[model samples]
Target chain A: MAKVPSELRYSKEHEWVKLEGATAVMGITDYAQAELGDVVYLNLPPKGTALVQSHKMGEIESVKAVSDLFAPVSGVVAEVNQAAIDSPELVNKDPFGGGWLVKATGIEPGELANLLTAAAYESFLEGLATSGH
Target chain B: MFLTPLNPLHRAAGARMVRFAGWEMPLQYTGILDEHRSVRRGAGIFDVSHMGRLEITGPQALDLLQSLCPTDVAALEDGQGQYTVLCHLTGGILDDCVVYRQGEGRFLLVCNASNRPKLISWIAGWQRRFPGACLIDRTEALGMLAVQGPAAPGLVAEALGTGLLALPRFHLGQGLFQGDPVLAARTGYTGEDGFEVMPAAAQAPALWRALTERGAAPCGLGARDTLRLEAALLLYGNDIDESRDPFSAGLGRLVNLDKGAFLGREPLARTKARGPAERLVGLRMVGREVARHAYPILESGHRVGAVTSGSYAPWLECNIALGYVEARLAEAGTVLQVDVRGRLAEAVVVPRPFYRRSAASGEAAPREPRAASAGA
Candidate 1:
């Protein structure tokens, strides 16, 4: 089973988001890393760049395949994880902790409604797992 | 829907299964890099039962095979195997296969999984020319497992309770393990010193378990690709295919012109006289990042060739690849750029088999290891 933190919101693409006032912390979900398999390279968005919700922010290349990281909420990019860039395998080791991709500030309040809660995302993953990837 | 004899074993070991060539084979057990390194430094066993096998027997078998393959099959002694390509009349490669001459009038032809149907049709079409030959498809009756690495010989010897170290490369022998027949051949796709074991289908799972218990690490198709790439061995579909000629793929040594008339002899002779326009070359990156398949090779901002197989070599510690380039640029030490993703990455042409081993000394030679990683 994949880890789903109750405090965070998730996108269908498997990115997790944590809101702190107007800023939101973002990273890949545990399920995403398990599916990607041994991340080798990470192309993260530059700090201070603005991103739109549901748009591709960057890409993460794993041993099996390369996946595009989608933005779950719209905001200006506040910080990008430099550590993840140095060691991409950390993403596979801990997708929710040190493997966080980016942080964004100045998000619209209505964007939270578009993201899925922990229970809903867990059910969504169950459907994907049973449906056979 | 597809499964190997070791499917349960793979699941127990936490392997990630993926569909490859109609088989649900493990893509990775621990991880691609870890599994790859285990094969390089120690030992690894691969469940290659998915590869198709055919047995051609009878007095006319040698003559039939000699007429089909481009290699000199008549020169092969009993218990020896030779890698050859079956080509069309136009000189295009039909399939690359290994022929094992088990005895007089007996032979085993191993082919790629995807091309089994096409090869069967091609061979059947030519059967009328040789009236008294028997071609039997033994893919379902046999299961193959490859034990590869520096420690392969010891592990295999322990498993079969026989001294296989005396067997020279490309030689085959029959042995008994637990009262079952096992065909052990010193043939492997990985550049390492290894052996491929062929056993009856009913005995596959037990043999696999025994080998695992005897210290042979379980590996999947993912590591198999990286290991073969490091050794400069060509993968049929990815490296060489129907559209490519043997001469253009740097497989000129396998073609024998003096052996007389065979399939695709006319075009091969002509192509030999007039050198191929493009030839296969090895590429070494200037940095850590990798250049994947289909990446364009450029010389002075112009497309010179395209990459067919590219990966980060685990043993070499660098990013390397095999690709087709204009004959002029195929020379070693030629500086070029590979368009990786959207940016041009600096690369240089190098000799094939990026990893070299001294056969006489049984030690790896000194070379600067490249710093890149391969994809599964």
Candidate 2:
């Protein structure tokens, strides 16, 4: 079963956000990691780069395919996770914790409201799995 | 999508299935990287039943094959196989094939699945002129498996209760397993020592089970592709087709121009006299970026060619690709740039067969391994 911790918010693109004060720590969800197979490389934006909600920030390449990473909320990137960048397999092993991709310092409150809560995201995934898509 | 004989087995093993050339084939069981590494370090078995098989029998089987195929089929002794190509009248490639001489008057041709129907009709049309020859589509009647890697010989021996290491490369042998007849050929697409097995379709599940239980990691098409690419193997549609001829694809040795008349032989001879405009070469990326198919190849800010197949080779641990470029720039050590997405990444031309075991050890080929040349 895919892990969906109740404290984190999610994006339809399969990104997860753990909000700490005005900063949003973002990473791909467990379900995303599973779908990606083994993560070999992560192309994350540098610190202080401006990001628009749902826009492509960088890329995540596995052995099979290349997927674009999207920003969940409009913000300025505060810091890119060096640990995950150094060892991409960590994203597949611990997507919710150390695998966090970026920490955005100035997330827009209105954009955060548009993100799905953990419960909503779980149901959304359930709908996707059941719909046979 | 058509199902293979081992469809149920793939499903039971939790393989991620996908449609490939009209067949519902397993794309991956665990992950492409894992399966790829397994085949490189140990052994992995792939259900390749989707590859088309044809049987030709007649007193003049060799004559018919020689007239159609570019390779010297007449030179093959019984139980030997030769890689060859079928071409159009215009000298464009139709399909690449491996023809095995099963007996004195019988031959088995293995071809790409997607080209089956067209090839059947193409050969059948010529068979009409040859009174004694007969053609049969054995694709649906037989199931295929490729057991590949350094550990393949031991695992195959354990599964079949006999050692096949004695069989020389490009040789075929008939044996029995689980009361069913099987044909084992010392040939594989992956640049590893292995066997390609063919048995009755109904007996596939039993063989698949036996191999998997004996530790032949059940691999899928995803790994099959990456493995072949690292070996510089040609993929039909991507690497060669109607637009490319054998000489241009670096398969000149396979074409027997000295042999008598054959389809496309004249055009091939002409093309040989005036060398191909572009030549296929291996490319190793200087950076981590992955170059995918159709990505532009640049030479000093000018577009030169496009990538045909590219991927992160697990064994090589680097991004490698195969592509065609102007013949003048096809030599090894030539620097090139590949446009990955929007950014141009540096790459270099290298010799084919990016990976090969030391010739002194294992069942490594005595000759330098042939570059996966041409699409046949």
Candidate 3:
């Protein structure tokens, strides 16, 4: 089973977001990393880039496939994780911690409502597991 | 889906299964990187039973095969195998194959599984002209395993109790495993010293078990693909197809047009004289991002070609690709650009075979330790 900590909010795109006041730190969930296999490369938006909620912000490349990473909430990119960029395996090792991809500040209030709670994301993942995706 | 004899074993080994060319095969066991490293450093075994094997035997077997395949089949003595291609009348490649001469009047053709039906029909259509020859599909009754890496020969000898390293490159030897006949050929796609063994279907499971128990890492198609790509070996469906000819794909050496009249010979000769408009070339991405299949190749902001195959070559520790570009721009070191999912990235033309063994020794030479990392 994938971990869905009660503290962080989740997106249908599989990103986990932890809001710190107006700043939101985000990374792909553990379930996302497990599905991706070995993460080889990551292309993240640069700092100060404006992102729209649910829009594609970047891409994550695995050995077998490449996937688009979506923005969970609209805001200006505040910081990009250089450690995750340099060594992509970190995302596979500690996706919930050091693997955090980016931080976004000046978040909109309505965007948080669009995100899923821990319980809701857990059920969503359960649906995906049973569906044989 | 069709299953190889080792399907049960793959599942037991915790393989991630996928549908490939109408067969249920393992995409990876443990991981592609780990399996790839095992083959490059130690040894790995691949269940390639899905490949099609056809047997041709008769007084006219060699003559019939020579007329269809582009390789110089008449030059092959008994026990020798040569990589060649089957072509259509328009000089389009039908499929690439390895033809093995078993004896004076017998031959074997190993082909891609997905093209088996087409190849059989194409060959059968010419049966009337060579009534002395007999073609038999041995795929259903036979199983193939590729034991690869530097340690492959020793591991295989210990498992089957027969020395195979003595077999020269492209040579086949007959041996017995548990008293059953098996054929070992010093051939592989991984660009490493290895042997491909063929045994009866019923005996495959046992043979696989013994090989793995003796330290042959069980690998899957995922690693097999990366290894072949790193070696610059062409995948039929991806790198060569009916839309392209062997000459344009950088395999002109295999097309023996001077030998005589053959299928696709006239067009191939004409194209050889005129030179190809597009030529296949190897590309090493300057960026970390991979340029996958069908991605546009650009030269000076203009679309010139498209990628046929691309990946993060685990062994090279770099993103590499194979693609056909305007022949004038196919020279090695030619800087190009590729649109990787709308992200334009720099790519440079490099010589084929992105990786090579340190020593230019024969196929059976002892293995050397690989670099600790790509940086080395």
Candidate 4:
């Protein structure tokens, strides 16, 4: 089963966001990384760049295909994960930990309520698995 | 959906299954990078049963093949194979295939899976011209497996209980695996010292088990792609198709005009003198980022051509690709730029086979001590 921690919120695009005070740490879910297979390159948006909710922040190229990374909430990109950029395979190695893509500060606090909870995201992945996508 | 005889074996090895050319095949077992490195540094086995197999028999088989293929089929002695392309009347490639002469008036044509139906119809048309010949689609009857890498020969020799050192490249012969007939040939799409084994479908599971037990790591289509790309081998649908001529795909050597009248000979002869506008060349990226297929190859600001295949060559530790550039830009030392995701990645034209092993020189490197013994 894919790990979905209760403290983290999920996006429909399979990104997980952990809220720490006013800042939100973002990383792809376990289910997302499994589907992507061997993340080769991660194109991250520049720090201090303002991103709107549901807007593409960057791109991730795996061996199979390239996928656009969408922002779950509107906020300023305070910091980008330089570690993940240097070793993109870290996303495949540890998607929930050091492989986090970005840290966004000054995000709307109300956006967290709209994101899916751990149980909801798990069920969503279940549907995808059965449908053979 | 089509499935290889070793589908269950792949599942047992934890391979990720994916649909490819109508076949439910493994896309990767452990991972593409790991499998690719195993094939380069050690050994790897692939279930390639999805490749179409057609057998031609009868007194006029050789004559029919000679008429159908662009290469000189009659010159291929028994137990020998040659890479050739079947073409249409207008010099368009029908399918690129490996023709193996098993016996007098008997040959096997191994073709790409997607071209099976089209090639079958074309062969049927040729068979009608030669009334005495017979063509049989034996794709369902045979299970194909490719064992590749530097250590492949030793493992294969140990498995078959025979020394294949005497057998030259592109030659096929009959062997036995646990008393079952096996067609073992020293040929593969990956640029490595390897053999493709065709065994009866019933025995495929056992053969796969034995090979895996003998330390041949299971690989899949994902690794197969990277390996072929590193070798600069052409993938049919991506690199060349019916619309592309042999010269444009850098396959001019496979076409022989002196052999006389055959399908596409006239147009090929005409194109040979005039030269193709676009030519295939190897591109080495100046940076770490990979330039994927359909990425534009530009000289200054002008788009010269497009990338046909590209990947981060794990063996070479750099990004390499194959692309068709303008005839002037196809030179070995020409510097170019590949538009990779809106960013221009610098590239330099290089000779084919970005990774070449010295095993072809017949001077074998001293074998490393077996890993199992070292740990024990």
Model 2 per-residue lDDT tens digits across residues A23-48: 99999999999888888888999998
Q: What is candidate 4's lDDT per residue for A1-133, written digit by digit as tens? A: 7788888899999999998888999989988998888888888999999988888999998876688999988899999999999998999989999899999998997988888999999999999889987
Q: Which candidate number would show the highest lDDT if scored against the true structure? A: 3
Which segments of model 3 are wrong by more than 4 Å? Answer: B360-376
The TM-score of candidate 4 is 0.95
User: What residue pairs are clashing in model 1?
Assistant: B317-B370, B317-B371, B318-B370, B318-B371
Show the lowest summed lDDT stretch of 10 residues, model 4 chain A. A58-67
| Candidate with the larger lDDT of 2 and 4 | 2
Query: Mind listing the fnat for each candidate?
Result: 0.29, 0.71, 0.64, 0.29
Per-candidate TM-scores read 0.94, 0.95, 0.94, 0.95
List residue ranges in candidate 4 displaced over 4 A.
B360-376
Per-residue lDDT tens digits for candidate 2, residues B19-95, read 99999999999888889999888899999999999998998777889889888898988788898999998899999
Where's the lowest-lDDT run of ten residues in candidate 2 chain B?
B367-376
Interface RMSD of each: 1.9, 1.1, 0.7, 1.5
What lDDT would each prediction earn against the true structure? 0.85, 0.87, 0.88, 0.86
